[model samples]
Target: MNKAITEGLLLMPPAFSNGLDQWSSQDGTVGSDTYDGAVNAAFVAADQDFGGCLELLKSETTQKLRAMVQTPLHPGCYLQIKARVKAISGNLPNVEIAGWAGGAGDVHVLDVVEAGPSVALTSYGEVVEVSAIVGTGARNGVDMPWGQDALYGHFGLNLTGANGGVVRIDDIQITDVTNVFLRDMMDWVDVRDYGAIGDGVTDNAAAFNAADAAANGRQVLVPEGVYALASNVTFESPVRFQGQVTAPKEVRLSLTKNFDFGSYVDAFGGDEVLALEKAIQALFNFTDHESLDLQGRRIELTRPIDVQDVVNNISTYAIRRVIRNGQFNVLADPAWDTDVVTSTASYSASTSTELTNVANIANIQPGSLVEGNGVGREVYVKSVNVGAQTLTLSQPLFGAASNQSYTFSRFKYALDFSGFSGLDKFVLDDIEFQCNGISSGILLAPEGLIFHVRDCFITKPKDRGITSHGRGCQGMLVDRCQFISNEQPMRAQDRTTIAMNVNANDTKMRDNRVMLFAAFGVWAGTGHLFSGNHWFHGDGETDGVRRAGVIFTTPNPKSTVVGNYIDNNFIEMTNEHDATPDWNNQYSFGGITITGNIFTVNDVAPWFSWIVVKPYGSGHYLHGFNLSGNVFRALNGNIERIERVDETYAGLDMSKSRNVVVQGNAFNSVDTPIFNPLMVRHTEAANATTWEIPTDGKLPFGGRARRVEGFVMDQQVLRGSNTAHYEFPYVSLQQGADQSEAHLKWSQACRGRVQITLRMDNAT
Candidate 1:
């Protein structure tokens, strides 16, 4: 909006053709004009086609030709002067229309830009328009510096510098243009009033600040135009934007009173991307408010926004930042796509951090998720040295190997927090991330504390949802959240992405729903509580074959997976990465309690078990584990044992794994009828050397007997004739094929019946 001030009533007479009422001669006399200050300069009612004219005759350089305008003056007024002049006859005079400035009263003697081209009359019979901007700033201008007693400007035709000539000046006009600069009498301050040009060329930052400074508890109004704010401008007061502003993101603009996205929408000409970017930046900086409430605006993002890098990589920040109550729609822009690269690296058993001689090392970005054979879950690149062909990982990979090829997938998140290491207390609450089957959800801070994601919906994340690649998840909490993958419609075995990945310890995941990715979650850390979650991962698998619901990618014996409803999913307790069962005093797969869970499946696979312990290396055993009060039911056919070692490898080292618990579980349509320890009796004939006893495969792990008590009795005669004679048989145990049946050998031939008692106890 062109807020240029409107002119008031004419300062001159209503008509210059009627008579020179306010006009005067050079000697300051009204109705008296002199030729060369001595002879005829007169007002003509009609001269040729002109409506009115001030006819003047100029002959000498000392001759002041016409009268100056007499008008009322004000302190903060802009006096605009204009006239149409022409050099009519005789020697062409260097004549022009000019103005004079005065103080306190209308008394004369101040020439303001008299020689300026704006008021020059050069051609004969050709109307040359002349004008001047006069205000309290100068004799002619816009900015009004008040506090003066009074100021006035006088306009007239000048011939003092001209040779002998005749000049005709007509249509002299003047008006008070003070409304453009007047703000003290109004309720708001306009940016135009502070000399702001909205042509998109001039920097209005200073003018914007000036208007805000003069607001005086009133709203500062930015009228409609494209204004460039070349510098950082902060509006500390209430501001209304009918216009838009442009500035680089490097500038910090704090709209303290209106910090929400709605205000930015108005400020950025309704560009949602620009609006959201600034709003989030303001949120992280804690401008005005610590939390940026988007007010449920659906923002469309065409690119990834680096949360911490936009703030210049502070590396250490403790302010609580929150972004809530909105949804971000990811556009199908190639710049927002994930980066995937296959690289070869050399590893060592000494340290898993140095992945050297890496191919495509320069293409691997920092914070990229590392995956492949022997790579640990949730491992990411902390830094990369392309020249040295090495990548410093956030943590060690799972297994030890050399010259291995790995895939580095760097997923672009809607909000990336990978730049800072100590940005603690971050929150994303009550929001939705719509990845559109292309982008990911969120990348967490590298090393922060108390990162909480609650009451949010992560929809269609292409790679993973809510990743913790560093120690930022030390005490992370994900509560009442839902992760819906884009590949959720695919079968469990065909799904590729995971809903989440955890690395740091002491994290709690409660009451969250996962839409069944290939792996629901990749867990590494210990001391976690995962409860009240229903993670179903079964689809079109008639054979009842699927991946593990939760993969213990590392040794975690302190975590509890309890009270969950798992569908067609099993728990995988493995040391596939680091095969040391008791490395660094951390017991492998032991001390974990899986209780009070309901496991249900529809298809049939006789070998499909509910719990599988996979120990890749020798001597790796399950030192301690618990499985109690669980209900396992198969719909189609019978399954194998409820808990067993992976059939592909040798069973667990039973001598080292003595504290295994498998009891109090109700099963339906499963192969094993019961799992309680069983006892049996075997009768021996006369002179028999061996007595075979059948054990009902009721051992805790289907392998070895924990304890056995037995005694031999006389079977043939019912009573021995020599009762005092030694007739007891020496005990020799022979384990059966499946290790369920027990065989006993006798040192001497004796007819007897042997009663055996076997038991395995791990209730503690």
Candidate 2:
């Protein structure tokens, strides 16, 4: 494609005579410019003309007509102009497109190009096409910063060539040639071309591999069919895998088994015991292990596992033993060995992790992993007893189980593809990736760039749906995707474990839907944009910790999560983690923008809060935060709309937070608008004397002295409910004066339900 086909922006066949709304005559001498059928008849024979041509009758004076195109043309884009011209008397008028920078009256021309003549003109008219490559340079003796300045183009016709000259111009068009070429270029290879069948039973791994290899740098196409994949496929170069289906659920890449995990196993050695331990550790990353009594004998396997193991199902005690050849083994004990257990028990949808069975529960123990064969669910045993047959899980099960076959075993990650390098610009589109009890669905290498995963469905990953690690992985975009039934749907943590370490930069997650996520909907990093996303029923299970709608956790010394924008999202029914609340760890020196979001907490709980800005360490403090244009609805319990507390301080102390603006927020059924608490001590006062308040408005502290500043809460509207009354003077503050003994009380009580429009200045 040429530059004009890619960069030109004019619409095709721009009919002008129908209505001259965007067109204006430069000279009144051009008259009788009606959009009637007579005007259009003059250019009927032109190839580019459809109908409704602009007919101009020129008088004795010089006649000129120009129409402005409001579209902003980009620099480096080629412009293609086409028009049908019919000249009736005297010389034919010339046509040209001119671009102007700044505004009208600036008289600064950025570009000017004349239309070229066509072949032979008939009695009707002739079609002419002109081209101009826009550049950033002087045009018409005026400096043209093509893209830098506000620019518009004009299509002008000079009818001064002949007196009483009648000219008919139709099918005027302008096109962006450069963009058209890049968007419509079809350089691809179909996977079916590589002798593969989409019968949903054939293993098409080789077919995809071959197509990707043949694709070189072009896209690999997968047609609308169910393609079965038995193994993982590697994309070694910059290539896209496009499918013919509209949604990812249409063209499925069904995996019969979990992704391979053998790569994570350590090599076997002569030291059998140590090798076995390393193999187990490599597979599960178990924090602690011990021996447990089975019947009367001490079982030779790991036991009493760490919370991480149970919460993430990293490993199960039933299959805790690793053999000498680096293979896992599940031991059988007579005390717990019984027929395969089946349950007619039913469970309701709840955020609780406890399950009741009431029978045949003597064998189950803590740290044991159980799988629901009928319901396709798994859980790590937190507690069990023969008396109640109650099994508490580390995380809540989103769905109910009934008439399900329960199998006991250790949970190991089915998929493991990590530590690979040189995989860049890989695209996975229009495919459904099933994890089948794996830790992650897709794990990128530490070194890769421009990885795009769009229009995809990923489900049932034990840990995360999709993730990447280290600073080397950047420029990843995940758009129009759905992530369901995962612990953490999308995570890009910084330098943690394989499950938590994702330090990728310039990553974006847009137009995605995440549901039934047991943890944070998205745990992202610096330069990340989470926009137009819907997250529901999230943070259901925190494993006794804090959860959030979206957590931006960067390390200390980095004052802010740089260049992050979270906007236009709807989040509902997300439970907070034990200590951390929603939108956690937002301490970026570069500032954060949280706007146009609607947060609803229907299930009331005491730990729920809209936001918490606290210092994790001495150097870790929020530099700038802008919380505006957000709506909080149906919030229950003693939840703070926005709280600022430094865990490092026990009393009124110096807070490192600065440049925080909270405005244009609406709260409904909220307990407190803002909560800033300080603990203070008192001492005996000396002889009484008249004391005036400090000019600086800082409360004088004597015991455990520390300085504190007030925060501003403005432009907030709070609506009261009958169930919970809203109280006034929502700003709670504590100030100590003269080392005198006095007690300050901050109460949370409602006298009556009433609507209040409130504002607080210098509220500490």
- Of the candidates shown, which would achieve the greatest lDDT relative to the real structure? 1
Predictions in order: lDDT: 0.68, 0.40
Cα lDDT tens digits, model 2, 69-107, are 443444323344544566555455544443333334534
Q: After superposition, how far is residue 2 of candidate 2 from its true place, in Å?
A: 61
lDDT of 2: 0.40
The alpha-carbon deviation from the true structure for residue 611 of candidate 2, after best TM-score superposition, in angstroms, is 1.5
Q: Residues 171-275, candidate 1: write the lDDT tens digits.
A: 666655666556457777777655465678778777777767867678888888878888878887788889887778766566887788888888888998887
Error of 1 at 146 (Å): 13
Model 2 CA deviation exceeding 4 Å by range: 1-419, 486-501, 521-525, 538-546, 555-590, 635-640, 644-654, 675-764
